[model samples]
Target: MIKSWLKEMEAEYRIEILFASETGSRAWGGATVHSDYDVRFIYKHHDVRSYLSLRKAQETMDFPAPYDAQGWDIYKAFHLLQKSNPGLCEWAFSPILYHDCQNFSSKLRRFVTESYSLISLFHHYIHLMDRNLKDIRGKAFTEKRQKQFIQAVRAFLLAKAIILEQKVPVMALYSSFSSSFPKDCTIVSFYQQLMEAKQSGELVSYADIEDAIFMMEQERPLLLELSYGLSKGKSIENELNQWIWELLHL
Candidate 1:
């Protein structure tokens, strides 16, 4: 069912990178808990139709249906290919990809294998760090420190992606970049809160976390300098669209 669905999508859109994440891998320390599959794919247009300039005005598609619990996100491929979007690298090795067709996706799988923009990924991590801090410090009605920790790990890895590789690395954070990253107020604040949580041994949902979240919200705008123009990734090859056309019987 998954492969066929992906194939059908390939026939419809020129898929550049298809990533599957949170499909739940045993090696990742995911317990026997029933986890939903989060599937995200990025596609690009071969024709002139992709340049409509309405990038955020619904040039993409997202749906959730027909599974134990699954998500489908279809993006304009050209949009993400530029600047080595971390989302592309994150999904490429989701440990649960159903299919990859139209050779375009295959190429992206390789291109990303080589390059990813550190600046853009840093921006992404910054936003995520802010979100985590919000969850921990301010009004995160739910106990979200686990997610915050995950974001911190991601942020740290993205910075290393820049420092070590000059581009975003894959979603899985390796030990190579795990030790440290550039820090700001929110980063330090989140770290401090995490330490407090560790020392107090209190429940994760403890109300004392709001301060960190508040600081993160305040520090959100500081990361804009790192994110600008990170989306303009590599230009698409003409052959990739030709492949899509062939698959579509055009």
Candidate 2:
């Protein structure tokens, strides 16, 4: 179904989708039975002449649910890669893939993993958690707020993995946490319980997430210190530029 959707999008937009994958809860291993598909993709113009335009073309497309399709132009994708954009990195590492033209997805996965800045990626997830937590603060535990809490939890864990493990965290939350902190089964068990509550339509207790956030907050200084101690990532602009050219013109 999603493949056909991508085909329709390609025909309508006259672009080649080089990579497409699931994002959001679906990709993160926390999705419930009612979850909608969140498809993210990267594309290049089928006609390279579009790149020669004086007026810039739109570099992104966003469609509404149930498909909830969104994509970046090749240039935009490369720009995000250059910044080690955590969202783009998740697309590369996503366990669920819909398209991977010319093995572009694997190429991107390896590139970001090898070159992403530890501090940048770590800070990205940390800030993400903080922002989401702020948005839900003083709010009732409605379904929307419940989702936000889960996202915050996931972000906090991912950031924790990055600083402590000195690696780009994996896309799936449970697997990433379990693998990164194999001895710490308590947090993993708590996460499982949280997910069960979420899936069962039970509003998870606010205190549960609050405690987790408090624990994460206590580790911030150590994570920051560890982040700086990790290697500064290499420059990837030249390589990414070359890769983009190949994708668009080859």
Candidate 3:
């Protein structure tokens, strides 16, 4: 079904998909049985002339309903990559690949690893956790919304891990938490319960995540200090341009 849909998209848009994969919970290894496949891809147009026009081609495409499908144009993806866009980095490194141009994915992965900004990814995870926490604020926590709480915990751990390790956190939330916090810690057990609940399709109602939250709060000031001291990294535009030329067979 996914392959057929990709083919249909390629024909309809006159674009070649260079890389594609499953993202979100499924790719991050915290998915419930009911989780949906979040398919994301990077593609490029065949008509290079269109890219040179003052009016740019649409950089993204989205399909609603039936199955969630979305794609980013290669040009836009590369631009984001240079800025250390966390979403693009996640998509590039997603564990569950659907379709990928062998050379392109590998090259992009290496570029990201070399050029990634610890500060940028750290901020990204912090913003994600902040937003999730805000959404749950002043609301009554219940069994039905346990999934949201689990996600919040995951985001917080990822943000904390980025600062403590001075690197991008692992894609899997469980691994990120384990690596950051000791195995025998109560917080680890708390997170483990949440993970098991999410995977087993059970509600993780009202976990005592206060300790985790406190740790993040204490770490925030130090993280901000480190972020201010770091550089945003250099552009890989020349390399990306060459890749684009090769991909278009120009």
Candidate models: Cα lDDT each? 0.48, 0.80, 0.74
Q: After superposition, how far is residue 67 of candidate 3 from its true place, in Å?
A: 1.9
For residue 79, model 2's alpha carbon misses the true position, in angstroms, by 1.1
Candidate structures ordered by TM-score, highest first? 2, 3, 1
Better of 2 and 3 by TM-score: 2
TM-score of each: 0.53, 0.92, 0.87
Question: What are the clashing pairs of model 2?
Answer: none
Per-residue C-alpha lDDT of model 3 across residues 9-118, encoded as one tens digit per residue: 89999998988988777876677767788999999897888888999988999987556888999878888888898888778788788898766778877888778887
**lDDT for model 3:** 0.74
Residue lDDT tens for model 1, 1-250: 7556655665776543344344332223322344344556554444445444665323555547543323232344444554455655655545555555544456666666555555656667676665655555434344246545545544544553454444455543432222444455344445444544434443444443445445444544544544553543454545446544554446
Candidate order by lDDT, decreasing, is 2, 3, 1
Clashing pairs in 3: none
Top TM-score: which candidate number? 2
In model 2, what lDDT does residue 113 have? 84
